[model samples]
Target: MSKNSKDTLKISGIDTSVLRIALGTWAIGGWQWGGPDDGNAIKTIHKAIDNGINLIDTAPIYGFGHSEEIVGQALKGKREKIVIATKAALNWTDDKEKIFRDARPERIRKEIEDSLRRLKTDYIDLYQIHWPDDKTSIEETAMELEKLRQEGKIKAVGVSNFSVEQMKSIQHFTQLSAIQPPYNLFEREIENDVLPYAKEHSLAVLCYGPLCRGLLSGKMIKDRVFQGDDLRKTDPKFSTSVFDNYLAATEELTQFAKDTHNKTLLALAVRWVLDQYQGNIPLWGARKPEQIEGIRDALGWSLSANDLKTIDEILAKHIKNPISPEFMAPPNR
Candidate 1:
């Protein structure tokens, strides 16, 4: 693959240069983030694509397929300009309360058709397994995904929230070219294993949650109540004492960003992620058009080694007892 720009990545089988940042649609799905507004969601999608972001990272379980429906609606005319990426392997019941892993071959067959219909596209640029299904062998899932590729339903096979061993298992069976793992300033667990492995294997790495679920955005006010179905309500980081730690870190980080880099905390967080690995594309989540504006700040600069050290020192100063995002994983049934 040939890349002409440092700001873009050449994903396998795709001719276009995918932007270094992707639009994450989980928040707009309105499932775990409260609820969705179709009009604004459509606007946000258009704005991101129009602003030069060519990659969209979404999933079937997000808002129970509502997000894809909106994405389908938004991409009616701009379809060719965007590299639509969505995921499967997770299933949900009618009550909207229970969701679990289900990567049976039969399930993936149905998932491709359903996703194609919902996305209003004849082919998907990338099809990803959302999570590892303990009940289904990785080889079984890879064979089914490879079948879809053979049928021209999907251009490339990808995996999310998967370990290096699981990814190797998929490679043993068929093509596995891309991987999406939780990666951000505070959540850098992938650096130890996934990043090195992906870099060695020439796999695309789409790092999600660059803003750490909006915590790095420097907008979460103290004592703010996240009512409704907001995931923050139960997130361990947002609990009383821990939240105070985050609050202080956010404030200091915000000041550090403004004073040192003349950038917002959101931009600092995103650029930090991108600088970790030149090819690493951080997925930025946004539910509104205004939320997309700050991304411009993230791209125009690079962080220095000294600055990185200072940032780490600041995080260590306040964010004691840091946590990972593993709690959000769905149980395999």
Candidate 2:
């Protein structure tokens, strides 16, 4: 890849809005923290921003705001240059603006204030609702978000973990500028509706878990038991029987990555998500500085149409079982 091509890709038809490769901070401040090796985590955060990663995605529940604090510390001087996207908790009542347990309007406002304080910034670039809450209607939550945007507290409004129907429901009330969904080689559920809806509406789709939570990283052994409170242990794909099969598939895919015009497995993984044309940007969570370097290495290059086709064929051949049965279904329903 050439340096000239860096930042050449756009996120949502916005010329300056290139792939906002986001760094998920949950690992830094949550399950992976205090594991005797935080130097790489902190170093990777700083390095990712320096490499033109404009977006950093985090949430209050990620170590209960510790992730935001870490991001703030990492972005101390360059805060204005990067976009910090965080989420409001998911427990607000539909009729009430205040969150009694998780996301009352008052609590949302308070949480935003606290997040801003911790981030050492005046306003957030994108403030997203973490997840849907049956207690509250998305309309009310979206209205509150719009209010905050108008007040200049948040520049954009986004949502995370919203299904196609849920996204359409919220769209009825407000312009949903963005959506963060877990999408990867193994997970193809969003392709049915979320991707098309986002494209039709000009919404930027920030994809989290782009590497299938490290399953597609071309790393990990069958006997690998997760240490500490890592979420991967609970993931169905990570089980010994399932993981071995996943690994074999990843190995075949990794070779395609190597042979198909020369990109690492990591690069190919990132490219697969970015290549999805629904204004997609892959949210890359790096625990080590080298991981950030791996992402950066993917920059300034793109997969050709033939390469993409080959990749599709390879995925179809190898990922036989798919992540889940629902993954094959259309999201429109």
Candidate 3:
């Protein structure tokens, strides 16, 4: 990935150019992480583009479609330059209590229109199924996406949080251009399966949680008190029993980054993710411009082969029991 945003990932079917890191709008929607301010969120989006990031990813369930609305409001008059990717198949109740998978053909027909209306664009650069719906077969889901592509509603088809088998199933019916998965320093399960499949199949890997939900940002402390609707308060890794272990690992990583490369933990983490594979694209999340200023520092620098080994050693020494990001998954209908 060149350790820089200068390199772009081109989906086989999409016409737009996407940077190495995409601007994630999950926090901007603000349902789980308190609430979002339109002014700040808009500025953040502009800053990300101003700083070389041209890809933006959002979902309808993010703040119940508020994130897509905010992203739509931010890209007025300049939508063509940015690669806008959004998801469907995940729906919530009117009261916003229960979120379940709904990848039925009828549901996708309505969801795509709603997303188009909210994104303020005629066609989405990349349209991804948020998650696989067990109730619906991959043939039905993939065929529906192909139909959308035929209609020009979306340029490329993608699936997030899908296993290798599921992706293979999807390919039998349609072209799969990308796969979005949660991957970070604290989480490496995808490295064993999903990444290899993407690499072998020529699919773009849009890696989410590159900063481990801000743990690799080096700003969270051991005694930090999470306020508001922040989802970290409920993350299993942030609980009392294991928080210290992860924090300790993060602290050591912070020191190693500074001592070895004179870089902040945020920059080092992004570089690490980019260096892991030749085409890995990390999705950087932010709610304010200031939070993303460090992304530039991550560019033009590659971590050494020895540096990766050191990181694994550090994690093995400090973290006794590691955990995956399974808790963040939505319910399957």
Candidate 4:
């Protein structure tokens, strides 16, 4: 199990230390905002850690390096206490060898160095390939990761947004310690491949988008008119009629919470993912204090058998798989 702090939840496994609940910082860097404001960004990150969250996730591509800088700023003095997980893939260019793309080993080395400088850390706790480059042999990219780990630059190696076959192929480089993918009540595609593979291999499965990109937060409604710049506008689930369908389904779950007076829709959504296994750690992203505040009620509880069956029934009736072609990261071409 885990050492339960008043604010943080810690879960340990055979391989490494796992913080059951962690702060995923993409939200503060304006994942939804055109760009996140520095003051607010600092506050939210500090608040998450202050509230006992010890792990943080970010990627170089998030806001074109802005997110990392913000994370570095937020964790200035508290660096040693926090476990940071960041990724490299889909750089400014695809030349991994050319200082841009996935081809050059030199580029990969430079990118890690640059990330270290930006992060203000001598070593990263978990370093992940943000996505796989299909152009190069998976082994070729993994070799660079192994090199980084050998240099004491990173504690563990992992991959984000990888398929089962891709993860297995990369594992040939060495034992991969973790795998990051999207998993939520609304999106369960990973259940069929990624989750089982992680379980069989003893790899950490970090579930990003645990809030379903804010849909499961119980904020967006069916008929709401979204402005042009919002990411949700492009999300199919937010489409006029489609959004209503999603809301209707969530409404049922919300009602269930009321019936027991025990859970919020956000808590139920988070608990549903956690219920899948002991290794599942949902990486929660928060934009403001309120966003983090909304999900706090979800912690410290588990769903009952009837609750689990009811959730499945609601999803089966109203939700379809939302994994679209756009959601799939394009192969490094």
Candidate 5:
């Protein structure tokens, strides 16, 4: 790809700069990941934008609106230069501790307004349903999103955590611009169908957790302990024998990166996701400015067929017990 062409991805008639990678604000929300410092989080967002990353993916549930607020503050006068992608249909209890999925018409209506306010934008570049609510018909949700699109509140409509069947059901009501799903070397359930469907339909694939929630970052150690609220504490992949298996795989993957490309496992992991599938955008999450530094290394590199085969062999050799991220799914209400 040419330098200019590689720097941007056109989806739904909007050109989003892919110069670095899309910045993910889930960690800055400071809920499941850990506590976050507002100053650091804001600086991290600035650093990402300064470094040429122009796409940001956030959700209202992320820190219960805190992430959007931070994003709004970060983009104070630069909103037009960046593309904001936020989600809806996921709400919290009155106390704001528990969260559930609700995509009813009334609920989505309220969510868009609230998200617009928190994001400090009159219109969102991309609005997505955070999850598939079992209680609401997919058509109903799609209709509401289509209504918003018509009204100019949102420029494009997308869905996250949706299956191929779910996307098909929603497509009957409105054209999908993108699909956000958890995709990385470890979690690849989408590769079977969702990916092919998106490609066939010309919908962009915005992949979340590109580093497997930091597992593929190559920073995790077997003795590491997570706080009570940390999502990884309860993640099956982090438990006893499973944690060891994953760690072993990471060790091998790290060596492969050094031997092959002289790059960090973090860069290798992100590059793997981007190269494995065409037009697959990885949402790289960061809470500190330093965490955003390695994005440069992730670019300008492509994995060869032999490199991909070696990665598969490494995964198959050490990961005797593979775990899925099913636990992160919210309850349908």
Candidate 6:
């Protein structure tokens, strides 16, 4: 599909011309995924934009402000062409290694300012609470974001990793434009409630980890080893027996893509996400320019009912030990 073929979604009355895919900067942040080269990260951002992707999802906690900085540098003169969707509320201690949720009104105020400085933008297109903070009342967090919206600091208010009840509670105070949730073939906990609720409430749903942090990229092998601060080293899906099961499933899925669609597993994985729900945007993470090349393939085709059934059968056949991305969650405090 052409760039124009990508659909648009409206959030909080703002007309956003977004592709089916968005560029996620979590990996570029280089905190959890692995150490990322600064030059490569900036190039990846440019490549995504050049390839027709308009929305870029980032967070302050990513690399403790490194990812946003790289995004700012990449968009120095090209900011007008892209939609910036960033998150706040998750803060780090002095050491920066221990991070926790803090959506207090005062914390939100400070976070927006810091994010603005790092992103090199006066007004953010979408500002989301990185995670729900149990320490602060949801009402307080919503009111703070509403205030920021009124002040023109953020165009839309959103929340990430929030439950249905938490969403309802916040909606009582202010309008929620979107919700960011981890939704991939392996991690689908949000489909039951978060996704349906967002659709019912007219909130845009942006699903992150579209490739399950590179597991569905069709590159992981049993012998692959992760080093440094790479999260895959500790990810449950990457464990011994579990990794074998997932790898087996991925290999079958990869073969299916080659035989059925004449595409790569990366394209098939993202297309499956787009076909599963209406108005769902899959946030694709990439740390290198070459990684964005598959965006076009993911757009033009979709999965059929039979294909979906076959995919389920493949998962059931090989993945005896399935795992969710629960370890990535931040502390409630």
**Model number with the top lDDT:** 3
Model 1 TM-score?
Answer: 0.97
List candidate 2 stretches off by more than 4 Å.
Answer: 1-18, 32-39, 91-103, 325-333
Off by over 4 Å in 3: 1-6
Model 6 ranges off by over 4 Å: 1-6
Q: Give the Cα lDDT of each candidate.
A: 0.88, 0.72, 0.89, 0.73, 0.87, 0.86
Candidate 3: residue 24 lDDT (0-100): 91
Where in model 1 is the C-alpha error above 4 Å?
A: 1-4
Model 3 residue 272 lDDT? 91
- Compute the lDDT of residue 132 as modeled in candidate 1: 94
- Candidate with better lDDT, 2 vs 3: 3
Candidate 4, residues 1-333, lDDT tens digits: the string is 223432233332123354566788775656444567778878888888766667889877666678899999888999888888888766564442322335346656877887898899998888888777777788888888888888889888878888888888988886688888888888888888889887887676788888787777777565567653466667777664667777888888888876774667887788778778666778888767656674456666677888888878987788665544254454464
Each candidate's root-mean-square deviation in Å?
A: 2.1, 5.0, 1.6, 3.6, 1.6, 1.4
Predicted candidate 6 versus true structure: per-residue lDDT over 1-333, tens digit per residue: 463453555566455667768899999999987776899999999899888888999998888889999999999998877789999888788988688888889988888999899999998998888888999999889999889999998888888999999999999998888899999888888878888898788788889988998889988778887888888777878866778788889999999999999999999989898887767889989998998888888886678899999999999998765687888998877
**What's the TM-score of each model vs. the native?**
0.97, 0.86, 0.97, 0.89, 0.97, 0.97
For residues 263-325, write the lDDT of model 3, one tens digit per residue.
Answer: 999998898988887668899999988987887788787888899999999999988778988
Clashing pairs in 5: none
lDDT of 2 by residue, 11-96 (tens): 33122454546787777766444342456667988888767677888876666667777788888788777777888854333553
Better of 1 and 5 by lDDT: 1
* TM-score winner between candidates 2 and 3: 3
lDDT of 6: 0.86
In angstroms, the error of model 3 at 311 is 0.8
At residue 282, candidate 3 shows an lDDT of 93
| Residue 93, model 3, lDDT | 85
Candidate 3 backbone collisions, by pair: none
TM-score of 3: 0.97
